[model samples]
Target: MTDAPGSEGPEPSEPPTSRREGGGLRRAHSAADASASTTTGARSARAEFETHVAHARAEFEEANERIKQRTGRDLILAIVIGVAIGVVVVASLIFFKWIFLLFAIAATSLGVFEFVRALRASGRRVDLIPQLLGGVVLMLSGYFVDLWLHWVLTMVVVVVLIVWRLLGQMFSRDGRTYGAVLSDVLITGLVVLYVPFLGSLAMILLSQDGGEWWALAFIIITVAADTGAYVTGLTIGRHPMAPRISPKKTWEGFGGAFVAALIAGVLLALYMLGLPWWTGLIIGAVILGTATIGDLGESMVKRDLGIKDMSSWLPGHGGVLDRLDSILPSATAALALFYLLSPLAVS
Candidate 1:
């Protein structure tokens, strides 16, 4: 392999710098391709995740809508509010008994306020101040004083309400007829008897020894009954219990309520109150009757007033009265049960 002078051997073996530069360019191109592939894969993954999330959200919304249609209310909101109220009540009952008295007074006042507002909305004259004052006094008397004093104060409040209304009408130039005044007086009386009076019974129960537990027991059972009825009715309600009063109520619901109340009563009496198991049945039956009647009575009042609810103060609960309807009457029943069953409880 002898080469002549000035011969270009193997094309002078490509320059080292040029070869390095060419290799660098090819490597850069390879890197760019890999980056593009990675970006595409990331986009595809993100798109898939977004689609799954959207589908899940749609399913949740659909379920919520179905519940609303079946219950005529937002079930989730109702449950949340209901749980919050339960917590407050339980805390007040457990931590300090006096706190419950205050809670009751406040609740009754609000309920009376709602009722008065509803009555006024229906073109009826109502005295809100006296009702609130009377309710507070009733609860205080029941808690601090004796049952007799509570009754006496209740009568005093009634008379004051009547006189207040009569004097207001007498002085006013509205020309409201005597019959109208009478109707107003009657309604005022009803407001007292329905809310404060029954609610005071709970105060009386709390005043007694071990009465707090009884109060809690009855309340739990009442709530259980309400929950059972709501679930059963929403699930398989057919025959109307009171089509005229409450079309949503059904016999099936009532049956469910009965079973739930009985179970709750039995458990509470046996474990918490330490009363005979049979007493639980009695408690359940009595509370069920009273609660159902109270619910129906409130519904009848709403029907007469031509209002869907007393007020929309509580979002999912309608009004304070709406929530208290069952509890108010059940308070009286619970107090009575306490007296009758106290003898059987373990000392």
Candidate 2:
């Protein structure tokens, strides 16, 4: 249809294909706008998540720094090492009892080695070879022989160490004096009695029927007390329990240790050892006393030796002796308790 000049004919109706094209374009634009909106929302969500993650990371770092500043050691590293030791011990204990014997032997040997080195550092002479050999024999005796034999062998080792030290002094090129020989003999006796003798008690415990569980129970309780003391002292400790010995240790921390030991003892007695829950109290009390004394005793030794650690063999923990201090004495206590409480245990 033709329209006159300056006049429209029926408003010039649009073509059908053109109208469809225009409608399609409008739909496409709407879709594009919706997609853009969705993308923006997703980006916002992602940014928020990242922000939260950053905040959490920052908080963790701050906490870690605080722990480091207070403890003079990396908390995470200590936990990792502690966990690794625990895994090895647990695996050896659970898989085979004899494997734990090997573990004990190795631990005692290392402890003796470290002690010898520490003494040597102080210019004191120690017979490392005899001590190591004697330690192995003592551990073997504890495992293979009866209780009486174990005691006899322990005394024999001490005497052997003393005599060996005396003979070495007599035959030495350095021409030792009586005072030096006496000191060496005394130190030798201390080493044998301290490391191997107490360690043998654990072997003895493991030799008994169902002794592995008791050993594990005592170990768990000791670890619990240590962990509780550490955490509590770091968080809210004020008054020092033994400032001259361990400045970081606090009464509050000791209380925490007591509580944790009590709980651990109860649980282990009831579940692991199949004993009366009340027995856990006794076990906990005994272990706590021994563990505390052991820790303090070691600290005193280190203070006298003028060293912060026995050695840096185990990172964040000092050395093997440092780790074994509590366990070594607790072993004796645990064995005694086993004899005392065996009647109450479930068969």
Off by over 4 Å in 2: 1-32
CA lDDT for candidate 1: 0.89
Per-residue lDDT of candidate 1, residues 162-275 (tens digit): 899888888887888878888998998999899998999998999998889988988898899999999898889999999999998999999999999999988988999998
Alpha carbon lDDT of each predicted model:
0.89, 0.91
The local distance difference test score of model 2 is 0.91
The TM-score between candidate 2 and the true structure equals 0.89
lDDT of 2 by residue, 28-70 (tens): 8899999999999999999999999999999988998888788
For candidate 2, the per-residue lDDT at 2 reads 78
Q: Candidate 2, after superposition: displacement of residue 279 in Å?
A: 0.8
Candidate 2 clashes between residue pairs 3 or more apart in a chain or in different chains: none
- Per-prediction TM-score to the true structure, in the order listed: 0.85, 0.89
